[model samples]
Target chain A: MDSSKVKVVTCIAPVNIAVIKYWGKSDENLIIPINDSLSGTLSMDFMCAKTTIIASPELQENTFWLNGKEQSFNNKRLTNCLQEVKRLASKSLPHLNWKFSIKSENNFPTAAGLASSAAGYACLVSALAKLYEIEDNVSFIARMGSGSACRSMYGGWVLWCKGSSPDGRDSIAKQIAPASHWPEMRVLILVVNDERKKYSSTDAMKRSVETSELLKYRANQIVPKMTKACIEAIQKKDFEIFAEITMKESNSIHAICQDTYPPCVYLNDTSHTVANAVHAYNEFKSSNKVAYTYDAGPNAVLYLLDSSVDEFMSVINYLFPPQDTAEYYKGLPLSSNQLSQDLKMALNIPVQEPGCLKYIIHTKIGEGPKILTDPQQHLL
Target chain B: MDSSKVKVVTCIAPVNIAVIKYWGKSDENLIIPINDSLSGTLSMDFMCAKTTIIASPELQENTFWLNGKEQSFNNKRLTNCLQEVKRLASKSLPHLNWKFSIKSENNFPTAAGLASSAAGYACLVSALAKLYEIEDNVSFIARMGSGSACRSMYGGWVLWCKGSSPDGRDSIAKQIAPASHWPEMRVLILVVNDERKKYSSTDAMKRSVETSELLKYRANQIVPKMTKACIEAIQKKDFEIFAEITMKESNSIHAICQDTYPPCVYLNDTSHTVANAVHAYNEFKSSNKVAYTYDAGPNAVLYLLDSSVDEFMSVINYLFPPQDTAEYYKGLPLSSNQLSQDLKMALNIPVQEPGCLKYIIHTKIGEGPKILTDPQQHLL
Candidate 1:
C-alpha cells in the first residue's frame, strides 16, 4: 500500500434504548457493567449518527469534529477508543500507521436526551473497523467509547452480558432477535421540553456504583431474571409481558437513581406526567397497549404494536395536546383520529398544557450499522 | 353530673416530619407500619391544628367539622378513632355516653403539602381525650386516624416503632428527645407552587406495599439501622450525621415510591430544584450545614442549626428568588444577608425564576399538645 494513500469510510448507526437499563460499572476502565441490560435498536431511517473516517499519512495528527465543531482529541475515552482500534488494526494492516480525521453528526436534536453518543461511537467504530480491514466484532471497541454503544452495534433486541471475567473480553453485546422477528413493534419517542442542565450519565453511574446499594442489589438479583423474561417475551412476541417488563424495569432503574446518595434525579414533572398517562392508557384498554421507558433524562420512549398506534396517538394528543399538531410528529406518518368520551373519562389525567412534549418521533426496530458504499455520503 | 351539662376542651398540636419515613403497612386495618420512623415536631407557634371538642346529652348525634366545613362522620378512619376514644373513656366514666362534637382547623395552607392531617388528628384526639377525662396516652388513638399522626402526639424528636405483634398495640410513638434537648435546631418549610393534582398518600402507600419489591426490602432491611443512627445523632447533637441521614432517608423513601409499579411521583421539578440547591449549599460550605426532607409532596422541609440559618437563607433566596421578597417568608423572621461572591460561585446552580417557592416558614422544635384555658380560644 502507498504510505501517502488516503482511505475513507462512512457509516450510519442506530440508537438503542435499554428496557433493562445498564447503570453502574463493575469495571470502569473496561466499561463492564454491573448488570445485564437489553435494548431495542431504533430504525436509522428516522434517527441516526452518521460518521466518516479519513486515514492518510499526509495528515498532521488525529483530530475529531462533532456536529460541525472541532472537539479536543485529548478526551480520555476518545483516546482509548482510537488506541484500541489502532492496536487491533496494526496486527493485520501495516499501512495503518497514519494520522486520522473523524467527523460525526446526529440527524436528530443532540440535546433532546436521545442516546446520540451511543450511535455516534457505534458509527465511528464501525467505520474505523472497515477502514482498517478488521472484519471481526468492534462492539467491544465501541463499548470503550460509551458503555451503551455496544448495544447499538446490533439490530432488533440486543443484550449486553455482564460477564464475570475481569478482563471484560466476554462482556459483549449479543443479538437476541433480529428486527424481522418483531416487525409489528413500533416506537414513539416523546421529547420533553426542558432547559435544565443535564446530569452526566458517566458521572451519575460512577456515583451510583460507589454509593447506591439498591443498584448493587438490582444488578445481583433483579436484572438477571428481567433480562431473561424480556428475551422470552420478545421471542414469543408477547407484547403484554414485554410491555410490563419494560415499564417495571424502567421504574426500577430510576429507583436506583433516586436511591443513590444525594440522588440523581432524571425524571422531571413532565416525565412523571407522561408515565402517569401511559399507566392510565393501559388501564383504560384493560390490557397492555403501550409501554414507556426513560433513560437518563425526562424524555419518554414508548413501545407498542402497530395495531395500537392510531388509537394511542389519539390518546397522546388528547392528553398532551401539541402547540402545532402539524409539526408534532416526525419520521413515520400517523393517522389522526378522534378520541372517544369513554377513553377521555378513563384516562382521567388532567389535560396537560400545550406542548409538554416538544415533539414525538415515530420509528421502529431496525437493522444494525450500514456502510455507505457511495462516496457522496462521506463527510470529508 | 347533669345530663344536659356540656363539657368542652380545646387543644393545639404540632406537625411532625419524618426524617426516616414510614411508607408501607404491615397491618393495613390496624394501621401498623412495616418499618420504624423518626421525626422532628415543628413549633406549634408557627404551624398547628387547633381542635375543640364538646360533649353534652343535648347533642342529637355525633358530628365533625374540619376547617369550619362540615364533614361526614361516616369516614372509616375518623369513625374508628372516635369509637376507640369512646371505648377507652367508657371504661373510666359512664358520662361518656353523651354525643360528641368536634371542630378542627390548621393555621397553614392545607394545599401546601405540610402534614396538616397529622396535626389535625393529633389535636382532635388530644382534645377528645381531655373532654372524656381519659388521661392515658392518646397517640395510639391518633394512629387509628392516620399513620404519621402518632408522631405528632409528642414534642421534639419522635419515633414510631413498627411493632412485630399482629395486634399493633405496641406500635406507638415514643419521645426520643424533648423540645429543650436541641433548642438550636431550626426548620424551614419551602412550599413549592404547583397546580397539578396531588397523589393521595393513602392510595400511594397501599400500592407501594402491594407492588414495590424495593419497599419491602427497604422496610425490612434499611429503616431499623437508619432509625438507630438518627436517634444516636440526635442524642449527640451531631448535625452532620443527622443531616446526611435525613437527606438519604428522604431519597430512599422517594426511591421506593418510584420503584412501585406504575410509579408514584411526588416530587415535582421545583421540589427537585430545591433539593439540588440544598446539596449545592452543603457542597459549597464543605460541610453538611443543612438538611432537607420531603414528605409525599413538592414541599421541602429543611433542618439546620441556628448558626447556619442566615447563610443558608441567602443561598435559598439566591437560587429560588421570590416574586415579592417582602411576602416570601412567613412565621419567624429571617435576617436578610447578601450572598458572598465566593459562596455563590461555589454553589454553581443556576438561579431559578422568581416565585418557584410559594413561601417559606421558619420554625423550631416545640412541645406537643397544649390545652388552652381561656374560653376565647375555642373554635365553636
Candidate 2:
C-alpha cells in the first residue's frame, strides 16, 4: 500500500419502514432491541442516503459532513461505528491506519421526519466495510450506530431478530425475501405539514422503556405473533393479511408512545386523517388496498399493491388536495386517474383544505446498498 | 293515585369524567364491563342533565323528549331502563301500569362532546327511581342505559365495580369519597373547537371490545393497579400520584382506541396541545400541578388543586388564547393572572393561534343526583 495513495468508496442505502416496530432496548450500549421487528426496504431511487468515504494517510483525522454541514466527531455512535470498522479491518488490512473523510446526504427532505438516520448510518457502514474489504455481515456494527439502521442493511423484506445473547451478535437483520419476490408491492409516503418541535426518538424510546407498562406487554405478548404473521403474509403474497398486520403494528407502537409517561405524541391530525382515509378507501373497495404506518413523526408511509396505486393516488388527491397540484408528488410517475362519485360518496370523509400533505412520494420494494463504480457518483 | 292526576318527579345529575376509563364490555347485553373504572363528578351548577318524569293513567303511551325534540321510545337502552324501573315499582305500587312522559335537557351545548349521555341517563334513572320510590341503588339500571352512566350516578369520586356475576347485579357505582373529602380539588374543562364528525363512543367501544387486543391486556392487567393507586392517591390527598395515574389512564384508554381495528380517533391537534401544555406547566413547576383527561372527543378535562388553578389558568390562557376573551370562561370566577416571561420561556411551546378552544368551564367536585321538590323545575 502506497502511503501517498487514497482509497474511496461511495454507496447509497435504502430507507426501511418497519411493519413490526422496534422500540426500547435490552442493551442500550450495544443498541440491542427488546423485540424482533420487520421492515420493507424502500427503493433507493426515490428516497435514500448517499454516503462517500475517502481514506488517506496524509489526512489529519477522521472528519464527517452531513448534507452540507460539518458535524462533531465526538458523537459516541459515530465514533463506535468508525472504531468497530477499523477493528474488523485491522485483522487483515494494512491500510486500516489511514484517516478518513466522510460525506453523507439524503436525496429527500431530511426535516420531513423520514428515517434519514437509518439510511444514513446504513450507507456509512456499508461504504466503510467496502473500503476495508470486509465481506462478513456488518449490520451489527450498523446497529451500534442506530438500532433501526441494522434493518436497512438488507433489501426487500428484512427482519431484525431480538436475540437473547447479551453481546448482541445474533441481533443482525436478515432478508426474508428479495425485491423480485414481491415486485408488485408499492409504497406511498405522505409528508404532513407540521411545525412543532419533534420529540427525539432516542429520548422518547428511553422514557418509554422506563415508564410505559403497555410497551412491555406489546413486546412480550404482541410482537412475536405479529412478526410471524407478517413473515407468512409476505411469503404467501397475501396483501390483505400483510396490510392488516402492518397497520396494527404501527398503531400498537404509537399506542405505546402515548402510554409513555408525559406521552410522546407523533401522529398529528394529518396523520390521523391519512389513516382514516385509508380505512375509508379500503371499506369503499371492500378490501385492504392500503395500509399506513407512522414513525416518531406525523408523516405516513402507506403500503399497497401495484394494481391499487392509481386508484389510491386518486383517493389521496381527493382527500388531501394539494395547494399547488404541480410538484405535489415526487418519485415514480403516476398516471392521471379520476375518482368515481360512488366511491367518493362511499368514503364520506370531508375533503381536507388544500395542502394537508406537503407532498407524496411514490416508490416500491428495492435492493439494499449499492456501490457506485462510476467516480462521477462519488461525493468527495 | 287518581286516574287523571299526574305524578311528577324532577332531578338533575352531574357529569363524570373517568380517570380510569371503561372501554370494553364483558357481557354486552347486560352492560357488564370487563374492568372497574373510577371518575370525578363535576359540579351540576356548571353542567348537568335535568330530567322530569310524569306518570298518569290518562296517558296513552310512553313518550320521551330530549332538549325539546321528541325521540322514539324504541331505543333498546331506554326501553330496558324504563322496564327495569317499572318492574321494581310493580312490587310496591299499583299505579305501575300508567304510561309515562319523560323530558330531558342539558344546560351546556349538546354537541360540544361533553359526556351528555352519561349525565342524561343518570338523570333519567334517578328521576324514575325517585318517582317509583325505589330507594335501592339504581346505578345498575343507569349502567343499562349507558355503561358509563353508572359512574355519573355517584358524587365526588366514584368507582364502578366490574362485578363477577354475569347478571351484572353486583356491578354498581360506589362513592369512594364524598365531595368534602378533598375540598381543594378543582377541574377545568376546556372545550375544543373541532369540525370533524365525532365517532360515537358506543360504536367505538363495541369495536374495541371485539378487535383491540391491547384493550384486553389493559383491562386485565393495567387498570386494577391504576385503580388501586388512584384510590390511594385520592385518599391520601396525594395530588402528584393521582394526577400521574389520571393522565396515564387517559392515555391508556386512548391508546386502546387507536389499537382498535379501523381505529377511533378522538383527540385532535388542539387536544394534543392542551396535553403538552399541561405537561409543560407541571415540568415548569417541577411537580405534578395539573393533569388532563380526554373522553371520546376533543375536549380536555384538567384536574388540579385549587392553589394551582390560577397559575394553570394563566398558562391555559397563554397557550390557547380565546378569540373573544369575554365569554371564554364560564361557571366559577377566576382571578385575573398574567403569564410571566420566565414561565413562558420555560414552557417553550408555541402559543397557539386564537380560538383553539371554544371556552373553559371552571368547576369543582360536587354531590350526586338530587330530587327537586319545586314543580317549577320540572320540564313537563
Candidate 3:
C-alpha cells in the first residue's frame, strides 16, 4: 500500500422495507433468516446511509465511526463482513496490506426500526468492496453483517431467498426489477416516533425463535406462500395483490414479534391509525390506491402510484392535520387537491395531535449503492 | 306474572386476567372460543362490575343500563344469554312472564380490555339466574354472551374449556379454586390507557380466525399445551411457571391480533415499559417475583406475591413518578418505603409521562358473583 496515496471509497445505500419480513435466524452467527423475505429499496437520494472507507498503510488498526461518533469495531457482524470482503480482495490484491477506517451515517435515526442497519451494513460492504477492487456481488458479504442488508444491496424490488445449505452463500438477495421498471411507484414514509425501539430486533428475534411456536409455523408455512405471492404480484404489476400482501406480511411479522416470549409491540396507536386510514381509503375507493407496512418500530412505510400520491396525501393531511408549527410535515408537499367527502367519511379519520406523527419523508424507488466520485462528499 | 311482586337481584363480578388468552371464535353468534383459556379473577373489593337486575311485569321491554347511560338491550348476545336463562326457568315458572331491567357499571372503564365484558356478562347471567331460581351452573349461559365471560363466572383460578360439542352445551367455565387457595398472590393492574381500545376483541378475534394462520395453529396446537401448563402452574402455586406462561400467553394473543388482517396493535409504549420493568425485576431477583399480562387494551395486570407488593410498588413509583397533577396516580397508594438501589438499577425503568399510565389498581383473587344483600346499592 502506498503511504501517501490512501485508497478511499464512499458509497450511499438506500433503506429497504420488507413486504414479507425477514424474522428469526437459522444460524445467528451467519445471519441466515429462517424465511425468505421481499423488499423494495427506497430512493437513495432521500433516505439512505452513507459510508466511507479509507485504507492506508500509515493506519495502525481498524477503527469505526457511526453518525460522527467513534464506535467499537468489536461488533462481530461488522468484523465478519470486513473479513469476508478482505478475503475476496486477497485473491486479486495479494500485496494489499492496509489498516481500514470506516465512517457511516444514516439520514434517518438508527434503531427506529427504519432498517438503518440494513443501509449501514450494505453501504459499508459496498464501499469496502469498491476500495478492495472486489467485483463480485456484495449481497452475500452484506448478509454476514445483517440479514436484511443483503436485500438492501439491490434496488427496486428484491427478494432474499432462504437457501438450504450447510452455509449461507446461497442466501443472497436477487433484484426483481430496476427503478426504471417501476417509474410510477412512490413511497411515503410516515415517521410516527423516531425514538429508539424499546426492544432490539436482535433480542426479539432470538426470543421468538426460542419461545414462539407461532414463529415456527409462520416461518414454515406463511412466509413461503407470502414470498411466492409477492413475487408474482410484483411481476404482474397487480397493485391490489401487492398491497394486500404487503399489509398482511407486515402484520404477520409484528404478530410473531408479539408471539415472542415477552412480546414485542412496535406499532403504536399512531401506526394503527395510519394502517386504518390506508385500509379505509382503499375500501372507500373500492380499489387499492395505497398500501401501508410497518417494521419493528412505529413508523409506517406506504407504497402507492405517482397518480394517487396527491389524493392520498390529502387524505393523510385531513386525517392527521399538520400542527401550527412549520415542521409538521417534512417530506414532499401535499397536492392542492382536497380529499373527497366519501373517502373522508369512510376513513372516519380522527384528528390526531401533531406530535403523534413526527414528520414524513417523500421518495420513490431508486437504484442501489452508487460511488460518490466527488471527494467533497466523503465522510472522512 | 306477579306485577306487584317484582323480583330484584344485584350481584358483583370481579375482573379476570387470562393467563391463557381466548382469541378466536369458532362461532361468533354462539360466543364459543376456538381454544380453551384460563384466568385469575381480581378481587371484587378492588375491581369489579356491579350489576342490578329487576324482573317486573310492569316493564314493557328488556332494558340495559351501563355506567350511567342506557345502553341497548337489542344486542344479540345479551338476548341469547337471557333466553338461555329463561328456558331453564320455564321448567318451574312455566306461566311466569316478566320483562327485566339491568343496570351494570364497571369499577374501571369498559372496553379498555379490562375484561369489562367478562365481568358485565357474568354478572348479568348470575343475576338473572338467581331471579329465575335456576340452580344449574350459569357459566355456560354467560359463555353465550362473551367467551371470556364464562371465565368470569368463577373466582381465583378458572378455565374456560372449549368443548367439542357443536351446540356449545359442553363449553363452560370451571373454577379450579377459590381466592383462599392462593392467599399470598396479589394483582396490581397498571392501567396504561383507560380510553377504549381502538380494535375491539370481538372484531379482532373475527379477523384473526378468518385471516391468521398463526391463530389457527395456536388454537389447534399451542393453546392446549399452554392451558395444561397454566392449570398445573396454578395448582402447584409455582409463581415462576405461572408468570412465564402468563407473559407468553398474553404475547401469543396479541401476536395473533397482529397477525389478523390489517392488524390490531393494543399494547402501547407504556405497556411495553411496564412489561420491561417486570421482566427486569424478575431477572434481578433471580426468581419470578412478578408476572405481567395485557389484555386487548394497553393495561397490564401483574401477578405477584403479597410480600412483593410493597417492594414492587416502590419500584413502580420510582420508575413512573406521578406528575404534580392530583389525578396522575389514582388507585392504591404506595408504601412509604423507597425502592432498593439494586432493584431500581436492575429495572432501569424509564421516566414516563404522568398520563402514559392512567393509574394502578391493587387487588387479588375474589369469589364469583355474589348477590347484594343491601337494596341501597341498586341504581334503580
Candidate 4:
C-alpha cells in the first residue's frame, strides 16, 4: 500500500424508476428480491448521486459522509457491500490495504421516494470498482447495499433477475437496452410532496413480506407476466403496452402495500389527482399518452414519449397550478400555452391553488455510471 | 281501482357496513354476487334512510323523490324491484291498481360512501311488503335494487349468501344475531369527506368485474375464507378476530379496486389518516380496540366496543380538531376532556385544522327495517 500517495476515484450514477416494482425480499441479509423487476435509468444530468472515494493508508478508519454530514459505516448492509467489492480488488494492487473515506450527495431530496439510495449505492460501487480495477459485475456488490441499486449498474432499460439459486450469485441486474436505443423516451418527475416518507422503504418492505399475502401472490403470480410484457413492449417500442403495464404494476405494488398488516399508505390526494389526470388524458385521446408510477412516497414519476411531452406537461400545469411559480417547474423547458379546455373538462380536476406540486423535473433515459475525468468535480 | 282513497306506508332502514365486502357480480342483470358478503346494520337512530310510500289512484304515474327532490323511476334496477315485489302482492290487493309515490331521505349525506342506497332500497322494500301483504322473503326483491340492500333487510349481523342456484331465489340475506345479542358493539361514522365518489359503487363494481383478474381471484379464493372467519367471529363475539378480518377485508376490497384497469380510488388522505389513527390506537393498547372499514368513499365507518369509545373519541378529537366547531362531531355523545399526551404522541398525526372531518356519528348495531308507527311521521 502507498501511504505516501492517495488513490481517489470519483463517479456519478443516475436514478432508476421501477416499472415492475420490487417489493418483498426472499432473503433479507443478501437483499434478494421476491420477484424479478424492471426499471428505466433516468438521465444523470437531470437526476443523480455523485460520490468520491479516497483510499488512504494514513486514514484512521473507514468513514462515510452524505451531503457533508459524517455517517456511520458500521451498518451490516454497507459492510457487506464493502467486503464484496474489496474481495474483487485486483491481485496486482495487493498492497491496497488502505482505509476508505467516502463522500456522497444527491441532486434530489433524500428518502423522498426518489430512489436516492439506489443512485448513491450505485455511484459508490462504480467508484470502488474503478479504484480497485475490478469490472466483472459490480451489480452484485451494489445489490448488497440496496436491492434496487443493482438496477442502477446499467443505463436505459434494466431488469433485476430474481434468481432461483440458493447462494444468490445468479441474482444480477442486466441492461435490456442502452440509453441511446430509447432516445424518444422521456420522464417528468412530479414532486407532489418533498417530505420524507413516514415509513422507510426498508421497514415497509419488511412489514409487507411478513404480513401481506397479497404481496406473496403478486410476487409469485403477477410480476412474472408483467416483467415479460414490459420487456417485450420495450423491445417492440410499443409505448401503449409499456404505459398500460407500467401503471398496472405500480398499482399492484401499492395494492400489496395497503394489504400489509397495519397497511402502508403512500399515495396522497395530490398523488391521486396526478394519476386521475393521466388516465383521463389517455381516455380523452382514446390512446395511452403517458403513465404514472409512485414509489414509497407521494411523488409521481411519469413516463411518456418525447412527442407527447408538451401537451402532457400543459395538462399537469393546468391541473396542479403551482403556488411558487419560480419553483413550479424544474424539468425540460415547457413553453407557455393554453391548456385545452376540453382536456380540463375531461380530467375534471379542480384547479388547485398554485403549489400542489412542489416542482417538476424534465429528463430522459440516461447512461450507467461514469468516471469524472475533470479532477475539479471531485467532492473530496 | 279507487281514485279518492290515499294509502301510505312509512318505514325506516339502517345502513349496513360490510365486513366481508361484495365487489363483483356473477350476473349483472340478476344482481347475483360473485362472493358472499357479511355486514353489521348501524343503528337507525344513528344512521338510516326513512322512506314513506303512498299508493293512491290519484297519481299520474310512478314517481320517486330523494331528499325532497323528485327523482326519475325509469331506472331498470328500481323497475325490477317494483315488478318483483308487485308480483308477490296478495290477491286481496288485486284491486290495488293505484299509482305509487315514494319519498326517501337519509340522516347522512347521500352518495358520500355511506351505503345510502342500501338503506334507501331496504326501506322501500319493507314499506311495499307491508302495504301489499307479501309474507315471502322480501330480501330477494331488495337484492334486485342493490345486492347490498338485501343485507339491510336483516337486523344485527347479516350475511348475503352468494347461492349456487341458477335462479337467484336461494341468494338471500339472513341474520346471524339480533342487535340485542351483542349490545356492546359500537360504530363511529367519521365523515372525512362529504364529496360524492367519482365513480359509484355500481359502476366501479361493473368495471372491476369486466377488467380485474385480481377481483376474480379474490372472489373465488380469498373471500370464502374471510366470509367463514367473519361469521365465526360474529357468532363468538370475538372483537379481535372480527376487527382483524374487517380491516383486512376492507384493504382487500380497496386492493382489487386499485387492480382494476383505470383504477377506482375511493380512500383519500383524510380517510387514510383516520385508518392510521385506528391502528395506532390499537397498537398503543397492545390489542385491537378499533377496526375501520371504508366502502366506496372517503368516509370511514369504525367498529369498536362500547368500553373503548371514550378513549378512542378523545384520540379522534385530538387528531382531527374540528374546522367548524358546529359540524365537528355527530356520533355518540363524546364528553369534553383532555386527550392523553402519550396517546397523541404515539399517533403522530398533525393536528388538522377544524373541519378535517365534517362530523362524527355515534351509533351501534341496529335492527332491520320497521314501521315508523306514528301517523304524523308519514310523509304522504
Tell me the DockQ of each model, to 2 decimals. Answer: 0.77, 0.83, 0.67, 0.70
Chain A TM-score of prediction number 1: 0.97
Task: Give candidate 4's TM-score.
Answer: 0.95
lDDT leaderboard ranking: 2, 1, 4, 3
Error of 1 at B20 (Å): 0.8
Best by TM-score: 2
For DockQ, the strongest prediction is: 2
User: Compared with the true structure, what per-residue lDDT tens digits does model 1 show for residues A1-380?
Assistant: 35358888899999998999999898888898988899999999999999998888888888899999999988877878778778778565754887888999999989888999999999988888888888777788898899999999999999988778887777888899999999999999999998887899989999988877677778888888899999999999999999999999999989989998889999988898888888988998899999999999999999999999999998888888889877788999998899989988987788888978899999999989999989899988
Give per-residue CA lDDT, model 2, range A112-211, as digits (tens).
8899999999999999999999888899889999999999999999999988888888889999999899999999999999999889999999999999
Q: Candidate 2 regions off by >4 Å? A: A1-4, B1-4, B90-92
lDDT of 3 by residue, B1-380 (tens): 56456877899987788888888888888877899988888778767888998877777987888898988867899889978988888565732587778888988766545778888899989988888888898898999988888988888899898888887988999998778988998888877654533766788888888888888898899889888988888888998998998888888887887777767777776777888888788889898899988888888889999889998888777777765435544455546468877777777666666666666777778888888979798767
Q: Residue B77, candidate 3: how far off, in angstroms? A: 2.5
C-alpha RMSD between model 2 and the true structure: 1.7
lDDT of 4 at B243: 98
Predicted candidate 4 versus true structure: per-residue lDDT over A69-176, tens digit per residue:
999977998989888877888767943687889999998877556888999999999999998999698797899898999999999999999998876777899999
lDDT of 1 by residue, B1-380 (tens): 36358888899999998999989888788798999999999999989999988888888888889988999988888988888888788565655787878889999888888888999999988888888788888788899899999999999999999777787778889999999999999999998888887889989999999988788778877888889999999999999999999999999999999999879888888888888888988988888999999899989999999999999999888888788877788988899799999988987788888878889999999999889989999898
